[model samples]
Target: MTNKPTILIIYTGGTIGMIKDYSTNALKAFDFSQIVQKIPELQQLNCTIKSISFKEPIDSSNMNTSYYVAIAEMIENNYDTFDGFVVLTGSDTMSYIASALSFMLENLTKPIIFTGSQLPIGDLRTDAKENLITSIEIAAARKNGQPIICEVCLYFEYKLYRGNRTTKISAEHFEAFASMNYPPLAESGVHLNFNEHHLYVPKNYQKKLIVRKKLETNVVILKLFPGITQAVVASILSIKNLKGVVLETYGAGNAPNEQWFLTLLKNAIKKGIKIINVTQCSGGSVILGHYDTSVGLKEIGVIGGLDITTETAIAKLMYLLSENLSDDEFSSYFNKSMRGELTNR
Candidate 1:
C-alpha cells in the first residue's frame, strides 16, 4: 500500500478535452481538474492522479519547437515529484511531438506516454474516455516496483506504439497511426497484454536527464521522382546556409545516376552539408548500394537512413545539426539509434 504511483497528466489541447455547447453548437475545452468526475474509470487505478493544462490550448497544427521545449522543461522541473507522465495532444501532430520528445529527453527512466482522441470527450460516441483511461494505466504500469515502460510511447485505438516509429496514416478511422516496420508494444483487448520482450531496458538508472535544446531547422526534404531536373536539384541543394538534406530516394535508396545530379550531391557534401538517404516507400529501409542508382549516392557520401520514418528522419537531422557536431561526428551519431528511432542491423 505504500508503493502507489503518482501520475501527472499534462493536457496541451486536443479533441479529447472538448465538449459541445448545445445552443452554440461549438466545441469548448473541458476542465481537466474535474477529470475524475468526468471519467469515473480513473478512480479504479491504484495510483494518485494529478493534471495540468495549458493556459491557452492550441490546435495540433500550431505545435512547434517552442512547445516541445516547454513540455521538456515541465517534465524536467517535476521529474522527481511524479512517477509517470501522460501527455494529451492532438493526433494530427502527435508523432512529431512524441518523436521530438523521445530525442530531447535522454536516459529517461519513467513512462511518458502521449495520447489523444479523435472525437470530443462529451460526444456520446467519443473515443476520448477510453484513450485517456488506458494511457494513464500504461503510464502507471510497473514491474518489481520499477517503471515498466521507461520510454516515450503513443497509445491510440487500443494499441501502444513506439513514439518515434509511428506515423499518422488515417483521418477518418479510430486506428489513425501505424508503425509499418515495427510492432505494437502493448495491445488492449479483453485484457491488457504487453510484449514484455520488446520493451526497452536502460543500462543506467541513475543517470541524470540530458535535455537537448538546440535543434536546427535549416534542413529540407527532396523526394525523388521520374524526370527530376538537374537545375531543380541544384537549386534546392544550394539553399543558403543549408546544413542538412533528407533525400527521399527510390526503392532501397535508389537515385538518378546522371552526372549532374551526382555532382550536385557531391558538391553539397564537399561544402560540409550532411545528406541522408531515406527510402521513398512507406515501409522499407534505405540500403545504399543495393541498386546501381543508389550506389552513387553512397559513393558521394550520403548517409543511409536505414528504415527510419520520414518524420523521424527530418526531426533527427534537425536535432543532430543543433548539436553542432563535426561532419564526421554528425554522420556517426545520425546513423545510431539514440532514441530507438532506427533499427540496428
Candidate 2:
C-alpha cells in the first residue's frame, strides 16, 4: 500500500474561512476541523489532510512581521512531518505575506502553496472550494517520490504564481492576484499544467530549513510624484532609525533632477541609509541609467530594484536589513536576485 502524502493546512484567517449566517446575514468563522466535511472532494485526493488554525484569526490588514515569523516557525517545526503546506490568508495581504515567507523560510524542499478566496466559502458563488481543493492537490503532487513544487507559491483563481512575484490585482474578480513580471508556474484548467521552466529550483535539498525571524521594520516607501516637495523629502529622510527606503520612482526609474532632491538622497546614503529604486509600474524593470533623469539617482548609489513589486520590495528590505550586511554588501545583494524576489541585473 502506498503511504499517502501528508498535507498540512495552516489557516491564518481570511474570507476563505468565513461562512455567512443566512438567518442573521452576518459572517462567522468556520471550523477548520470540519473542512473535509464541508468540502468532501478533498477526500478524493491521495493525501492525508490535516489543518491548524490561528487561535484568534488575524485580519489580512493586521498582517505584520510577528505573523510572518509565526507562520515561518509553524512550517519549520513541522518540516519533517508534512510533505507540503497550504496557507490560507486574506487576499489583500497575501502577496506581502507570501513574499515575506519566501525569504523567511530558507532552503525549503517541499511545496508551500499560499491560497485564499475572494468570497466567503459558504457563498453561493464562492471560489473557495476549487482553490482549496486544487491547492492541496498541487501540494501533494509528486513524481518519482519527489515533491514537484519545492518553493513558496501563490495559487489562486486557477493560476499558480511564484509567491514573491504575486500582487493582488482585483477585488471584484475571482482572479485576485497577478505576477506580471514573471510567468505562471502552473495553471489549473481541465488539467493542472505545470510550467517546469518557470518553477524555482532549490539549490540544496540536503540543507535543513532555516527560519529567519529577525526583521528590521525601520523602513519606508518614498513614492515619487509630480509635485513632491523638498521639505517632504527631507522629513522622510530625517526619520529616526530609518535604515532603508523603497523609492518608487516614475517610468524607467526616473526621478526629479533638482539639486535639493539629489542632495537629500546623497546625504541619506552618506548617513548609512540604503535606498532601493524600484519602478512604480506593474511591469518592466527599473532602467536606472537608461534616462537622464535617473542618472543622478544611480550616481548617488541608490540600488536598482529590477522588476520587484512594492510589497516584495518592502519585505525584502526588512529581511535584508536584519542580516547586518555592510552598506556595499547590502547594495550588491539587493540588486541580485535573492529568493527570486527580483530580477538579477
Report every candidate's CA lDDT.
0.90, 0.92
| Candidate 2: tens digits of C-alpha lDDT, residues 241-311 | 89999999998899999999999999999998889998888899898889999999989899899899999
Query: Which candidate wins on lDDT?
Result: 2
Summarize candidate 1's per-residue lDDT along 103-207 as a digit string, tens digits.
989989999999999999999998888988999999888888788899999999999999999999999798899998888999999998999887888898889
Model 1 ranges with Cα > 4 A deviation: none
Q: How many angstroms is residue 133 displaced in model 1 relative to the true structure, after the best TM-score fit?
A: 0.6
TM-score of each: 0.96, 0.98
lDDT of 1 at 263: 94
lDDT of 1: 0.90
Candidate 2 lands at a TM-score of 0.98
Error of 1 at 229 (Å): 2.6
Clashing pairs in 1: none
